[model samples]
Target chain A: MADFSLFSRRFDVKRVPGFASVALGVFVMLYMPVILLVVYSFNKGTNLAFWEGFSLRWYVQAYHNEAVQEAAFRSLYLALIAATLATTAATMAALATTRTKKFRGQMLIYTLINQPLMVPEIVTAVALLIFFAMIKVATGHTGMIYLIVAHTAFCIPFAYLPIRARLESMDLTLETAAADLYASPWMTFRRVTLPLMWPGIVAGLMLAFVVSLDDVVITEFVKSAGQETLPTFMLGQLRRVVTPEVNAISTVLMAVSVIFVAMFFVLTGRKN
Target chain B: MIEIRNITKVFGAGEHAVTALQEINVNIAENEFFTLLGPSGCGKTTLLRLIAGFEHPSTGSMLLAGEDISLLPPNKRPVNTVFQNYALFPHMTVAGNIAFGLEMLGRPKAEVAETVDRMLRLVRMEELKNRQTSEISGGQQQRVALARALAPQPKVLLLDEPLSALDLKLRKEMQIELKRLQSETGITFVFVTHDQEEALTMSDRIAVMNAGRIHQIGSPRQIYDHPENRFVANFIGDSNFLNAKLGNIKDDQAELEFAAGRKVTVPLHRADLSDGEVSVLIRPEHVSIAEPTGNSHELTGVIENIVYFGTDTHYHLKLASGEAFMARLQNNPSEAEKRAAGDKVAVLMDAKAIQILRD
Candidate 1:
């Protein structure tokens, strides 16, 4: 038999009850809803709150729904285009801020790039809606372009932060040495700066993709008629009725977000 | 060859401005191993950077091989630099780093490879050619930096305290290695360092600077034996300064009077010795301790302490007027018991060994 005294000295049982209860409460509060939704998506019962038995009927229904399929494809397409555009703009902004000497209005430019993160999303959505409406009235055009523009604007800060941090932490002596070794300014950037900052760029792109993919409010406000992204489509379906098919669609979106975040971690984790 | 004329570098504007270099002028000869030696913040590295084209002089022109290249950027100038930190690209292998300069010059692929192999052999780093920069040791990194800088065949090379980060033994080894490389390549080298020993060991000529001003420029022997001012004398080696007054000036010598009515005749290197007040400088090794030898110019002092360094010993003495001075003596076994603390000894000074410094 193990000695009770040694075990008591090594392990503190007095605080276990309080700590364990707090942890359990947090876990249930955070993950319980998602876990319940996923479990009920397999329920044979049509009622979302009650499970009759295990089955894949909701999953099959979600796959066969033409409206859900179209919405998912649209969301993916918007995310890809917006993420690329945002990352490209963010790279230029990061380089301008970090690579050059401090100049007048530097602080103002930094604040402008990060304004979306500080201001409420609802305000941005309403503002973009009014601005796009005016443009449509002036030009008589309506398409997915308005939604893409709004999402890309919102994602710029997410991409800018990581790229700026990477550039700041880089050793400037390497670049100077490259110039001393007969490399032109453009060649130095192409050969030295790009290779070292690639990981940060990839991480930023992935973060923007995930953020744009999960957006709902901005999409709902900026998107024109008949341009319902997956989240907006899910919201519409929920208002009309409650079904496990909605849970199935949400599970797929969550999985894609998880994969993107994982890729970001792996890309930025390597030793330079 | 490089010529820097009337160079001044001010760091900032208005109240925050700082003068890093002021009206500096230097002419480094072709294939010369010259050095800019000073303490930190003395603008030695700034002067080197100006020559390397990394910085433009505020009010000066830099001529390279008789061509005005002051406005040319570093990439367009025929110069290379070995940064103090080695600055090896961590993403590249040793061979890739050494090949970078040649490749930037648009050399053919086969020529780049051959030059890379030659550089690897030059630094004795052929075995580590495929290793990443982070995987190499500091000394090895230094070798890679040197090879990388030399591979492009630049007309001039600038080294900014490249050996300061190395260990003592390795630094000593690299000092000789650097001298050998300079001679082998016959490239003009403008080395910067704060270590007096390193400058004395490796440089063919050195310019001593202080407070953004150059005090003297000469060969190692001239700089060590005969410094122009108190700064250079104190900076290069150990010296004892005695406050004195000039008594009379001859054609090639001068009479000086120290405190306690001590007078001595010293040779002058310059014809104009008319200054009334002067400071007499003598190296510690030049002073000797002996008994009264009927020499009127000799001064008596009491030994306060004896510091025994393995090859030599320093005797700290207090003179009659309470001024402290030091004399260095060889620590031979036969002379081991010659002097001790509290002993009275006469300090001997040779007329040729004394330097009269102008204030």
Candidate 2:
């Protein structure tokens, strides 16, 4: 039997106030670091060992740097291409795995798709370097194509989780009913299934883009001279000098990542 | 017209094989609102899915309006189904949902708009055309589902418990609406439900199914007035069983001697009994509380319990032979006028009310 009460049966002002204090305490503990980071990105300090007063010089300096600007653009371009490719592949994988019954060795194929995420990034970097070397020997080509390929492989698993989650959570009865209503497979997918999954697909694509934007290991191994991504360029700059400009760029990247994650929640989160 | 012949569906294979339907044969006439009524796991839904082409029969073929459609996919078939959940597109507006089937058929934009408007007005939802599906109530969604299914004007419309999601009052209203819609459209509406009252009220003909097979198929009155088997009789309505043994056999009537020294006459077929044991089934409403019977069926007993309903009262009677039977009184009576619990009484029943079940 159920009490079926909309409110709590036991009402106590003292207990309610005590619970509110505990919840507020948890919030401060979790968000204090993020509150500190944004406040100090504008600090006028040469060294990130401590934050000084706020100034516009670091922001101005970061904008004027040629190498940093070029690498940032390169990273943006690579992340865009890699995210598109990876999200497309992951979307297809999610559909085939969830909508259709298992084909031969489906488990093996799934494991292989998710392998780059599980295996050490260093191993993946080394493997891609070798594989690219073999391809170069056979066809004789040298380009940033290898770096893009490596980043896409690493981002696919991250992209796949959200799409697969969305697909599994979806009620497939609508799709079957759509089919019975004379919508072909392609039309049913476009009209009924895709609209329902748009939120998940966007989340997955953004996740893959952010992962590619932050990647360092694979790009370091695969890039030739003058082809370093933003992350690899940051690694080079950090080796020479650790400046507030690095903090400025890191702050910007972290902000972008936060924005994407926030958008993900807004798009996919249920009201309840 | 739809024809299903030797339709057998088996799931799994080898050692894991399970047969879900067994050589089902049925011919559903055009424009007939048929119902497949049974309990859960009775394969009624499976039969509907097979007709909708959601499932392929493992053994036999099906024909729709003289064309062999057995190998056709669901989208290619001339049928649409309103799923148990209604299956309304959650992302689309009501108008968009209804227009989906027409759009899929490559209809012109003008014609699709005209048809969708006609259907919206038909279901009386034209004002709510722009509303999201989540904003509407269940009964409204039921109408939307019906409008969507009928907008395409498929040869047959399949409804899998379309009204099961609503409360009792709404369910009754939707039942009447569904009947009217079917009659006006003149398309085959094959409904599947377990509720007997719903099946009896709306269906033109009812097929009583059990355990993956149809028990009987007849008009609603035929099914309610005369059920073919003991299971059908028990499933359809409330009936009281009186233990009896066969006394003698005659043409078109059999003599049954009840255990409590009462004899009842019933229609006799060769399958009625030769017999070792048998039972007589009479609906509770048909049994009378008064005792003016002569040679039809008469019994003396004590009223163990009295249940006074608004329209009728039920008397639970216990015989001297330790058998309990029930009789219904058409009118309500005061406690002082009615026989109290544990009071002795006599009851009578018509011979036409008795059905003999052979064992």
Candidate 3:
């Protein structure tokens, strides 16, 4: 009937000139390397730079390699422990920050809880490396606990954000209603708050798990001599040899992180 | 029964302090439906929160059935509230929500189930017992909230504008339902609402509040028929305020001289009555258009506007003194001849219906 559009078609982000090509350019810039890596992972040739015929040779080799198996197991174990610990601490922090009435220094508390996310990853890695180095020299013990603790600390903010959002969206009066019905604080949290924020918690847990699983910087710096996670092992392997087996391990890791991230978005995007 | 003695609530501290309620003293009798009636931000909800144990008074104490409950937490108090937004737990079924309070009180499984069944029957929500609270309509959620609050069998039930979220028809229905539940359960109800009609219709006694003070406290009829001051009179209903000159005061009556030299005798309810310069309040329904042969007691005014409300018609009039007045007349076939706008009419006020209000 009538054109009531506020801006001309040229101003529309999707309809602007070269929008599709620019979008394609961005996609290629972001994903072309990963796509090439994945493509070469199926190559029958030993070189990662050239793809010969299609084959699952590297996938089979990655599956059978003892170093790959051990690093994969270590990555999964570290992610499980770190994600669980981070989610627990994040849930408590989210509740403390969202449930109580506004007090002095609340903004400061928020910034402190999210310190890792705000600071550069390299800075955190160096800080943790130096801090843990002293403890290693003092106790003469260097175990996976250092890596788990570092990863958990880094994942706290990732887990905290989604849970805090969920807590803030929740109706405060529901908790009041629970208390009005003679429910103690613990009972109210268990019966009302916990059940309602379960989706956000699950989303946060998945996000933290994915974050811990794919982390390379902190793991590289904090890990001991022999305790190489999957990512660190792949990094060492790349220095020694240019092979598609590392590409295969990377594709598997990418697949896992994508699945978990998809699930995270689904959970957090839920209306209720 | 609950007693609030010299209760005052002040929010914040030092320079930012705000007095929400000041020197409030009210004693609610057992099983009586007492209402805290006021506009929003007038501290009505604050008073209700104090009584529900959600907030402790900044000063003074509260007693529930002769026991001091001033320091008790909300969970420790034997009271429940139906929040304004219903606040139904979205994760729980209706029956589960209704049964939660009992389970928390350490009631036996059989008793909790029986109580939940009874409450569901009480609120007529049996069909939606298994449904999640998020799936229910607003009215149904309101009922579930009521049932959940009442299932605890508290000594008193506090409702903080619980019907405000429902549509008009549902609000009316729930008003009647709330009144019925109050009487049937024999528990005291403390309801808070800004709607004057709802307060007048359901309250056994109403405490009209304003600016952190209780202006008046009485039965509905007493508050409506004999409001103590200007705020209560203006807040409860429509009124025509006229400047009158007080002549003489008897034991409980006074003579008021209005415009057009119309003098009428009115009952004096307040002890602050003076000899000159007073305001007189007359309800629209109490004033009528006088016939052509009206005498000295009639006031001369021109009809400014006529608003027809199906059941009744309100005639807006401008008096000879340039003051505005309204007269409501019921629409009946056998009534007097209809007066149009710009028509001159003699206004006759019932002497006893005129109320003397303090400034």
What TM-score, computed on C-alpha atoms, does each candidate reach?
Answer: 0.94, 0.90, 0.94
Best by DockQ: 3
The better candidate by DockQ, 1 or 3, is 3
Q: What DockQ does each listed candidate score?
A: 0.77, 0.68, 0.83
Better lDDT candidate (2, 3): 3
Model 1 misplaced stretches (Cα beyond 4 Å): A1-21, A49-54, B292-296
Per-residue lDDT of model 3, residues A1-272, tens digit only: 77857546547688778999999999999999999999999999997787689999899999999999999999999999999999999999999999888989999999999999889999999999999999999999998899989999999999999999999999998888888888899999899999999999999999999999999999999999989899999989978887899889999999999999999999999886
Inter-residue clash pairs, candidate 2: none
For model 1, state the Cα shift of residue A84 in Å.
1.1
Compose the digit string of candidate 1's lDDT tens values, residues A109-193.
Answer: 9999999999999999999999999999999999888988999999999999888888887899999999998899999999999
> What is candidate 2's lDDT per residue for A1-272, written digit by digit as tens?
77756456567565765888988889999987666655666888875667788797777898898888999899999999999999999999889888997689989988987998789999988888888889988987788788788888888988888888888888889999789878999889998889888888999899999999998888888887799777888788889987778777877888888898788778667631
Fraction of true contacts retained by every candidate, in order, equals 0.88, 0.86, 0.90
Cα deviation of A21, candidate 2, in Å: 10
Off by over 4 Å in 2: A1-40, A44-53, A102-111, A126-141, A270-272, B269-276, B290-297, B334-337
- Report residue A25 deviation for candidate 1 (angstroms): 3.8
Q: Considering DockQ, which of the candidate structures 1 and 2 is the better prediction for this target?
A: 1
Candidate 3 lDDT tens digits, B1-359: 89999999999999999999999999999999999999899999999999888899999999999999998999999999999998888888999999989999999999999999999999999999999888989999999999999998999999999998888999899999999999999999999999999999999999999999999999999999988888999999998888889978998888888965688777777877779888878899987786545576668888999998889999999987899999998889887446778888888766888888887
Every candidate's lDDT? 0.91, 0.85, 0.92
Taking all chains together, the TM-score of candidate 1 against the true structure is 0.94
